[model samples]
Target: MSYAEINGLSLYFEGHGSGPGEPLVLLHGGFGAGETFAPVLPALAEQRRVVLVDLQGHGRTADIDRPLRPELMADDIAGLIKHLGLGRADVMGYSLGADVALRTAIQHPELVHRLVVVSTPARRDGWFPEVVAAMDRMSAEAAEPMKQAPVHELYAQLAPRPQDWPVLVGKIAELKKQDYDWTSEVATLTAPTMLVFADADAVRPAHAVEFYALLGGGEHDAGWDGSDRPAARLAILPGATHYDILHSPLLARMVVPFLDAPA
Candidate 1:
């Protein structure tokens, strides 16, 4: 366990494994913590130093008076890499974390060596209409019903003040409503990238292919030897959904190789 004082927040993170290869930083989704990757951490850490980050307002990290923007969180990640003396790292994030990871690579390309984005779209409108509708309804009023979520239990156990759960919910709701389109940044992204998502994720399947095309992927068939293939990889896990993809072993299987591959 460690705390990196970056910007105005004391970001929390934990180191796993001490094996060879570049360190891989793992970021969890909204309302989730480093523990969100708990099941696969051991496997991912087997051959790479995995740093699990708890984004601001999640887990042990306390919230400040700021909007929960991916760009801001990405900055915190960039600072964290510097503070930890890692120089550069391979970053992988799920859902909300995926948005932050994308921003990290875009905002500070020098700080990220490679990226694995899981279950998130390049544009805000990439989500299905139903998902958008659900997000639209996210509010403090839903806090009581949300207690059944695992995130609530974890927050209750680790948050400095459990009663402030509604605050986190409100911030996330506001963030969900905020419009953002990173198509330009993503189209020009310089980092080697891999996109992972469930076949039945909240994002539109066609948009996934489009995102890959922007990254110079899914355009040409790799040679029999894979010598002509682009560096980017796109995997849509079968029989998986956005909700359970994080805990899926398949996620670790796909992520480990991409982060370990030489660019």
Candidate 2:
């Protein structure tokens, strides 16, 4: 357990395992803390140092006055990397955290060695219409039901201001209502990336393919010799859904090999 004062935020993170290669930074989903990755942490940390971060307003990190935005959070992540003196690290994020990780790679390409984006689309419209509608219904009132959820239970235990859950819910609701499109930015990302999604996710499968295409993947077949392969990779886990994919052991199985691949 550790805290780094970066960008006026008390960024909380914990380092696990110690092995060779660049450290891997794991960012959790919205309303979730670093502990969200507990299921896969052991497998991931086995081969390299894994740093689990509690992004702003989640877990041990208290909420700030600013609205929750991926671009700003990305900057905080970049600053955290610099503060830790890791120089460059592999970053992986799920859901809300994936947005921040994607932005971090886009905004601070030099600081990210590689990136893994799980269960997030490059644009707001990529989500299913039903999912978008659900997001539109998010509000402080939704916090009550979520209190019974595991995420909320975890937050209640770890959040510095547990009573502020309603506020966090409202902020995230507002953040989701905002429209964004990162197609152009994603096309220019310099870091090698891997996009992972469940077969049944909030994001449309077509959009997942499109997202991979923007990263210079899935446009062509790797030749017999494999020299024609794109730097980016995509994986759709079978028998998984967005809600449970993060906890699936298959996530580590797919991620570890890609992170270990030659640069």
Candidate 3:
């Protein structure tokens, strides 16, 4: 367990394994901590150092007075990389964390060598109507019944102030209600990026293709010799949904090769 003071937040991170190339920095989804990746962490760390981070208000990192915004959280990640003296690193994130990862690559491309965005959309509208409606329904009241859920249980065990669980829940609810669109930013991103999604995801499938297109992928087929492929890549994993994709072993299977590819 290590904590770095970045952007006025005491960001918590754990390091595992060690190999070559830039370290892999992982950001977990909302209501989760670095432990969220426990199921696949070993596979991801086998070939490189993996840095698992608890984003603002999650895990052991206490919340501050600021709202849970991706842009601000991105700055914290970039600051953390610099603070750790990692000059540049590969970043992978899921769901809410994916939003921060995308923004980090966009806003701090020089600090990111490779980016993996999992189970998130480029725009708020890219999500299915049902998902958006669910976000609208998120509230402290709605979170009451969820105290028995694993996410809340983990919070109770690891959070600095377990009583703040409802506060975190309300903050997330407010964060989800905010709007954002990063299509233009994504289209201009310079980092090598891979967009990962579950076949059954909260994001619409068409939007995934559009997200890939913004990254200059899926516009054409690779030649027989494989020279026409774009720098960006896309994968929709089988038998997975947004809820369970992070735990699927296939997530590591798909991510490893992409991160291992030569830059």
Candidate 4:
């Protein structure tokens, strides 16, 4: 376990597994921390060094005065990497974390060798209307009700001050209200990327194809000799959805090989 002073916040990270292979950084979704990947962490760490980081205001990392923004959170990740002396590492993030990974690759290209963006899209509108509506309903009022839910229970058990849950909820709701579009920036990213989503995820299937095409994928079929394949890949796992797909066993099967592949 370690805490690095990054971008004015004490970033919390824990290193899992030890080996001589490439390092992999795992970033979790909103309302979650590193332990959110608990189901797959050991399996992944078996293949490479997995660094789990809790984004600002989550897990052991205390919330700051500023609201959450992808660009700012991406900076925090880059600073932590430099602090840990991992010049370049494979980055994988789920949902909210995926947005941060995309921004990291966009703003600090040199810090990331490969990126795995799971359950995320290039634009805010890519999310289905139902998902957007649910997010819109998130507010301080729901914080009390959420305490009976697993995410809040996890926070209550782990947060520095469990009583701050309402404040966190209000801040997250405010952050989600902001609009963003990263399509042009995503096209310019130099690092290879993999887009992974569940067959029944919050994002529509068309948007996944759209995201991949921006990274030079899904435009055409590789020749029989395999000469025209794009560096990036896209996977939509069957029998999975936005909420539980992160822990699905298939997630490892789809993600690990890409991380292990040559650039």
Candidate 5:
């Protein structure tokens, strides 16, 4: 575990693999921290340096004493990357982490070489509000055993894994104290990027398509074209729901190659 102080917040992270290769930073979703990427990092480490960060209010990272928002969280990440001296690297984020990833790229483009966002929603629509509302309900009911669902079992229709339950529930609580708005930040992104989603995830596949269109359509489309345009790319994974896909191998299948591919 490593720690960095950025924007008055104590950020915690785990770094693995050793290489001269460009680094890959993994960011976890809401109700999750860096630990969510534990299962998949080993495979990725074979080819590149891998680092996972626990965002503020999650994991070992210290929660803020004041109100928090995604934009503020994004700034925290940008400061951390610069503080670490990693001028550019591949960055991948899931769910809420994807929101931070998007904002970080837009706010600090030179610091990010490639951007990969999983289960991310389009910023134009009211998708972020829908997501936050669901999170609100889940967090409020987290302590109720009768209402508490098995973290993995809850998303079994998408994938099967039983890791990091307590951490997820804690993160939900942390989110309740946050005040991020993801919709307004999308249009600002200008990094070479990819948006990966699951067909069954809470963030619908259609939003992924709309996100690609927002980046620009045709060969310039970030959705289908793996070409020169890097601001964004979109891939929809079948048989995945919001939370479960974080642990699923399918995410790695799309992400590993994308990260390893030449930029």
Candidate 6:
């Protein structure tokens, strides 16, 4: 466990595996923390140094009282990288984390060597307004019950794992009010990229397709293959939902090669 003061916020993070390999940073989604990558860590750590971060208003960090946007979150990651004296590293972002990765690669190109975005749309404008609206409604509905119910009950309702209910609920409650718009900022990325999609995911695959089109270029395939060309690439995991892909070995196989490619 470690914390870094970056841009007026103390960001919580952790690292695993030994050095002498390329560094890989992992960012989680909204209402999640660095531990969201727990399932994927052992494999990734075998050959790469894995850095995991909990974005502001989540995990062990104190909220910096700023609006949540991709740029700001990206800056937090960039600052942590610089502060830790790391060279350019590969970045793996999921959902809200993916948005941060997109923004980081675009705005702080020198900080990231490669990029992977999963379960998140390419363009902010492409996200379903209905999903966002539903999220708002769910949050509103959760408020009163949340006040009266034990945090564990909420976790039993949401997470597959049951040990860290208080932390999860607290993070969810805090980040619920956050919002961001990234439509204009995504085109600036120059890193080699991969956009992974879960076909059964509620998030639109078209968003990932359009995003891959924007970030250099990549192929969109509904099948799973580890090989992709230089510019950019896309792959869809058939029958995998957003949460399902997190634990999928197929997703790991598809992703590792792209980030491990010769630079």
Tens-digit lDDT track of model 3 for 199-224: 99999999999999999998998899
TM-score against truth, every candidate? 0.97, 0.98, 0.98, 0.98, 0.77, 0.80
TM-score pick, better of 4 and 5: 4
> In model 5, which runs have C-alpha deviations exceeding 4 angstroms?
124-185, 217-231
- Superposition TM-score, candidate 2 onto the true structure: 0.98
At residue 72, candidate 4 shows an lDDT of: 93
User: Which lDDT tens digits does candidate 5 get at residues 58-111?
Assistant: 656656554445567878878878877888877888877887787778777888
Worst 10 residues of 4 by lDDT: 153-162
* Candidate order, lDDT descending: 2, 3, 1, 4, 6, 5
Error of 2 at 164 (Å): 0.7
Error of 5 at 208 (Å): 1.0
Ten-residue stretch with the least lDDT total in model 5: 154-163
Q: Global lDDT of each model? A: 0.90, 0.94, 0.94, 0.90, 0.68, 0.73
lDDT tens digits, residues 1-263, model 2?
A: 88999888999999999888679999999998898898999999998999999998999999899999999999999998998889899999999999999999999999999999999999999999999999998888999998888889999999999999999999999999999999999999999999999999989999999999999998888999999999999999998998889878799999999999999
lDDT of 2 at 237: 95
Segments of candidate 6 deviating more than 4 angstroms:
136-141, 144-184, 218-230
> 1 or 6: which has the higher lDDT?
1
Tens digits of per-residue lDDT for model 4, 55-101: 98898888988889889999999998899999998899999999999
Residue runs of model 2 more than 4 Å from their true location after superposition: none
What are the RMSDs of all candidates, in order? 1.0, 0.8, 0.8, 0.9, 5.9, 5.3
Where is model 1 poorest over a 10-residue stretch in terms of lDDT?
254-263
Angstrom error of the Cα, residue 177, model 5: value is 11
- The TM-score that candidate 3 achieves is 0.98
The segments of candidate 3 whose C-alpha lies over 4 angstroms from its true place after superposition are: none
lDDT: which is higher, 4 or 5? 4
Candidate 6: what lDDT?
0.73
